[model samples]
Target: MNKTLVAGALALTLAGCASQQPAPPFTLTLAHINDTHSHFDPSDARLTLDHKAVFTRLGGHPRLLSHVNELRRQAEEAEQPLLFVHGGDAWQGTGYFTLNQGAMNADVLSRMQLDAMALGNHEFDIDNQRLAAFIQGVNFPVLAANLDASHDPDLKGLENLKPYVLYAFDGHEKERVDSVKDAGKRPVVAVMGLVLEDMPDMAAHTGNLRFEREVDSAQRTVRALREQGVKQIVAVTHLGLERDQRLAREVNGIDVIVGGHSHSLLGQFSNLGWADGAPYARQFTNPDGRGITCVVQAGQFAQAMGQVSVTFTPDGRVSRCEGGNTLLSDNVFYRDIRRGEQHRLNEQQTQRLKAEIASQPNIAMVAEDPALRAHIDKQYLPALNRAYGEVIGHLPQALKHVRLPVDGSGSQIAPLVAASQLYWANTPEVLAVTGRRADFALVAAGSVRNSLEPGALKEGHVGLELLPFANPISLVSLTGRQVAGLLLETINASLPADAHTGKFPYAAGLRYTFNETSKGRGYLDRIEFLSQGHWQRIEPDTRYQVVLNSYHASGNDGWSTFFDSQQAFTDRLDLAFTNGKLTAFPVARLSKVNGGGVQVHYINQPLNCQDQAVRCNTDARAFIDYVRERRPMLTALPESGVTLKRL
Candidate 1:
């Protein structure tokens, strides 16, 4: 062996070792938004800034895009690895969605250049075909690791709807590293997506697609990625904040979770008069107890954006995660100079508030993305404006819709919705279909999307924005025991501190006291039925005719009891009268079909209506009629429908 040969071989071996060495510590800046819900324009926001109540416009898509683009620019300047993603649910809220469907969503979101998005349950609000079309239109991947779409023809083999995507980021360039072979030993970050397994309970138009349990799918994906030598892992989930925390606790290798569905705004915003939430980029101990998993989410309706920066060790352990949520606003601000009127801030107050806003870490006054704003204005706004322009009626005072009972009262708007359903049931046309008038009406808090603002109300406000689902009115006969079971089951489902409060029940001719800390058989402290201008404890044996939306009748969102009891009446449902007699009548049953379609059937023969039989009563029509009957003004019911007491 010569000296020259030995030196050359040694140098070659050293070079090989250097090439195989572990990558350096990496920092990833994650920008995320969630539950935007088709709010293209700014919504009204009220904030208490510096002990002064003020009115201002808060986030819209145009402003959100501006902030995200700025962050992208900053990340590019720093040469840092960055990912921008949507948590889920960018559909079905305002008049834009009602008029344009998912076309507008696909167009707008594609332009934003998202890396990946979690599949939200509301995405299934339309049929499988439309959902497939929306997914096809988007430039980024629509992800759901738990979804099994093999059985559905529309979503069976989508190129972009994958379980996970891998990215390899070098100092100067970031490339989509889809395969382990493609990655070739470079440091890789895998972003996996997980959605709710209980899809049927939350969404009505899922088709043949089935969802796996979120934790199970996440664990499997993380393990697979680890086996493939992908160290850094991010899970984009639509499982809500608490579920994201649970996923962080249970999943071993995930470093961060960008979440939505519960629409949690993760940050301290109490100073801005917004509800305070868990701190942003909060870390949870992984299953191994040594690794850290950070969770973050933005507020609903494009109101806020969350930015998190995480530093990871070579072994994929998060050393630190820190970030905050910023509420995007415009410079135009207002103050309540008079009791009920909002006045534009003068130069002095405006300048002072501007200074204060600058000092706040989470409030960012940003401008709208000019191009996107122009696109919305030119392409979509005119149609929406004309469609929603007609005045329906007026609200003398604002009716608030709180999901959970607060300060001893439940939603002021949901009860109104329920009352409308009951009122429609008593109308001559509806009475011809069911032989009897409804004893009470039930509605879920989620059914009413927003509170009713005082002033001249428009068709767009009620029909499109407030009750956008447009669920058909349904009639069901329930015994007192069955009704009690329905209420108890739904109440218990919404009882968890982290549960989706949208399932909380509100009623028209019913009222109950709920003990939040109850350990008894059920949470109901007491239940009563309003009858003949009097209140009485409902009898267990008495059968009552109930009016509810078809969505609830099909047993969605913790209303399984309704389905189990009403399944027998798919044909002709028997109605019970106060005279202790049952009359068999042909009942109208509405069933959800493919592609956001509804299937209607009459048990025997169709009811005789003066006009269209099936079109005699609809959810929106009922509300419209009630509003017309009330005339010049609409107000909340005189009684508090729910009394919630906590220990």
Candidate 2:
């Protein structure tokens, strides 16, 4: 061979080797929001890293759009594929959604250009017709693999609701193959979605729909996507964090799981192998073993946006993943107040957007009437007073002021309502009663919405606070054993001793002692049921007709033990009571007696008002006098007459 030929061939061989090398990994960015629930603005307050609190000034739709646009700009500059997704519960929180059947919020969501969203429980609040109408207006796909809309005539039109979608970047294959063993270009990217299995029951009011098994639906969807020649897969799920993790571990072939529902803030990669005793064994190799599925979710209410970037190898395995939740309203992101005109410019820009939207006819409907709306100042006090008047015999003190933290028992008005219902049901028709049956109730400290001021209590305010959610009463038949099991579960679910020292159940016709340090859930040592003005032991084998809010009857508060017992004769408790007939119930007077006067014999702890911030420290007679003077109009009741009639 000649020297020239040899040199040329050698150069060609080296060029071929370089071309066969793997292509550089590309990054795909996913932005997500969940449980927005019509909160177009930031929460009650925005917190800083230094723990300094600042009231939010900019959180309306316009500001959010600006922020989203900015993030898209930055993502585009980075040459990353960006996909915007929502985790569900987009409608039915405030007047913006409820009053208009989610019309305004749907318009806003459409304008925002959501790429995909999962089905949330609240989406069904308005029924199937309204849900379908809302979905029809949205440009993006509403993904729910488990929901069977075939049976529902209203939702049958939502044929566009798919389990998954595939987005492919053309010409990516040639580059990837040239860089890796001289193969062809990379395949298309696919994103799948799954809704929670319990969505049907949870969202029963929204529509007449049903959800299938989540794991089965996910498996089927992943298989179909793989069959369609789409290798890169992303699962946007509304099954919550724990269930999402479970889905990731059980369902194979899924590359990532974008989670929602539980509202977890997950940006960094967390190993799901620990779930269900699975080991963190990498299933595929991409030069770097980044694992099979990457899961991420943003917290509820658009408080933060999640950014997840994943790199896929030519062979379709994830090489790397990185992301974080960006604080939309931080000092760094905003113009400093000290900047004066600059800050004012941002404010002006925000105001202009708000004005543009505010000018719309729908904005007038969004404005809530404080008079009718349930707020601490307007509704809770009156309801509390009515319940107290019906249950309590007399005011203990001359002033009869029920101080906040009423008895230093860590009980609240809701629990008191539960207790009152229990006490009311303690007749011959109701053999035995357990659960939240007390005139003086205590809910989880987290449940109390607000505190009352030192003044006369009114029926209106009490009604507002007690019945804020408009949940009706329910009655359930349970054996004595089942009742005892439920009490144990309630104690087990309460806060730990070291976490919050003072905790007590709201008492109606009963009082009990609980030892927080006890193990195995049997924390209640002695339960005393009041009979003929005396405390007595409750028999364990007798049947009882217990009355409670529908929320509790269904075992929402870790009272699953009650339902697990398979008791019979479950009925709506609301059917047993009449509205307005119990109007003169004095909550303040009841609080004054239950607040501190008599130490119920069961628990050694003395009843004293500890937390002044929440207790009702107002003169009962004076508050009633004040109510008479002000005479706020009563809310119009439904056609149901005022009488305690059983359903």
Candidate 3:
């Protein structure tokens, strides 16, 4: 009621309003890596040492740790909010993973102090049980937004796996009186995980853990986070570059994406006329058009690290991004020396850059962290030495990949795989069931990761080459129509994959005349199957027993044709080949070997898929067994004894 008091109160209110300000811009440095793939040891990098280019391996857990530690220190000095994250596939690909079954990588990654990681398909290579154990071992959050693991007793309640986490780094939230919409305190970051939708096709047994569509899961998650008043959102994904780009375009709330799984070297890849791409990070307009989204990925094998520097407005929109792939590659620097780029091994420009390398600075290659190296050498190498290096056999000649393994040509490994599968199909037990020998075996090129090198091939070498996916061997019955369809799909998968994709199917006891001209899954000109001792043109209605890896038998890699017409999207199938007749042994019934000692196994049994559990997984075991018993040494290709001709 007093005029003086009212004036005083008004003045105080005005003063408080004048002092309040809008929230200042926040900057964050997001460091990302993907697809380390059990490459515990450093890679052989090409570098310049002693004034000349030399081949040296770089990148191993030791250097990876060292490289990241140095970067963190640099980031701390710059006073930037830094977050270290992995995109996924930390398991499988090397002897280190094969021996420890990912436990070793888990401990090593934990030491790296990751803020978070997405679940890669390889994480499920073993089974849900092992995946649960791996999740338990790591200290960081393991995320998969679409995961539903409630049904399995081991993964119930889903406490161990989180879809999205309201994660915070070393940063602070503040009050912003200047803007009513921006006035609040929240954590520094919110990272959501989205894995590949193709996990069912990749893993033989995922145990009841189901994956929802990434976009659907992401939409729901973003809404939930936004409702909770969190602004900054990052999607750490294993969906690779193409899908991640699509995600950036489609998803509303995601600000940045750190991705993996295609092993794509986004920005750092040499444009060798292969797949060309933009530099490490690219910006896309959001689907809602409210903001811009940045996408980034580090190349596979821990050989490089992606650093994304982002500035965000108070409302969580990205202002700008400065990000690129840092080649921590200890391999030499020649990859950067574009062939005609003013400098070559014989060029004068080398005098300047080469001198820099020859001088005291000595072109810095990420030195292996002594502590991490010691851990790997002392604790890890023993198993690797015992399991991987022990000589399984000696090779007389190098088994070079002559052709792309896809389309059933290019690599000796393809034909060799067919021969190996055929041997197993013809084994006494399998022969007794179908009352006939298997017509042919189906093998997809992607299944083999590496080639058999010449010299004393070690058991660990085989494990690394084949990769340890415990996928079982399966026998299925298919009519000639289905088999022919499969062959066509295999051819269509061959070309673009001559060096990239690996869905091509190779066969033994089967030969096909392919007409590349007809195009689009109908490329097959003719297909033949081996009969009692001769090759016969396959009949469309005739049923033949086929031996293939369990992954394919279960209808993956474009082979959905394997299942009967009635079944689609079916899970946990124990499929048995029942109806139809084989031309070779049409008269013979189940469990009876007709003539020629070729009895086959028929299915009265449900197709319960089980782990082969050999010392080594993949066909590497069969390759080893075939080598020891049959050729003891490979002088040339087609060691499986089934060479082919195209008519």
The candidate that wins on lDDT is 1
TM-scores for all predictions = 0.90, 0.60, 0.75
Candidate 2 local lDDT, 1-647, one digit each (tens):
99999999999999999999987665677777777767654343222211222223324344455556666778666655677888887764433442345776677777777778887766875567778887887888888877777767788757557666656553321121211122234446666678766553344253445677998888888777667566677878877666776676777777777777665554321221111211111133212234477777766565566677788876566777666654344222123323234433355544543454344321111222233223322423343334443221221211111111222323333343444344344422322322323222223222222233323334433433323333433445566566556666655443322111111124344456654454323356676555667766767886655555443444433445434443332332222112312111111111101111111111222222232322211112212332343322221112111111111
Question: Each candidate's lDDT (Cα)?
Answer: 0.81, 0.49, 0.65
Reference-based lDDT, residue 354, model 2: 44
User: How much is 362 displaced in model 1, in angstroms?
Assistant: 1.6
- Candidate 1 lDDT, 1-647, residue by residue in tens: 99998999999999999989976689998899999999989877888787899888889999999999999888888888889989999989898998888999999999888999999988998788999999999999888998889989899998989999998886525788777679776667889999888877788788877778888888998889999888789989898887998999988989999999887887889889877887788899988989899999998999899999989997889998999899998887777422243478888988888888999999989999999999999999999989876687887767888787756767888888988888878888667756777888899888888887768888678788888886667777788888888888887777665568788788988888877665322567677888898988878889888888877876788787776764445532432221222223355555555433333356764432222323322677778878877644888888757777755
Better of 2 and 3 by lDDT: 3
Query: Can you write out model 3's per-residue Cα lDDT over 520-628, one digit (the tens) per residue?
Result: 3335667788788898988999887776676666556555575433143222222223232111112112221211011222223332224232221335555666666
Q: Candidate 3 — which residues are off by over 4 angstroms?
A: 1-24, 44-54, 169-187, 271-279, 331-364, 395-412, 423-435, 452-454, 464-467, 488-502, 509-538, 565-618, 629-647
Model 1's number of clashes is 2
lDDT, model 2: 0.49
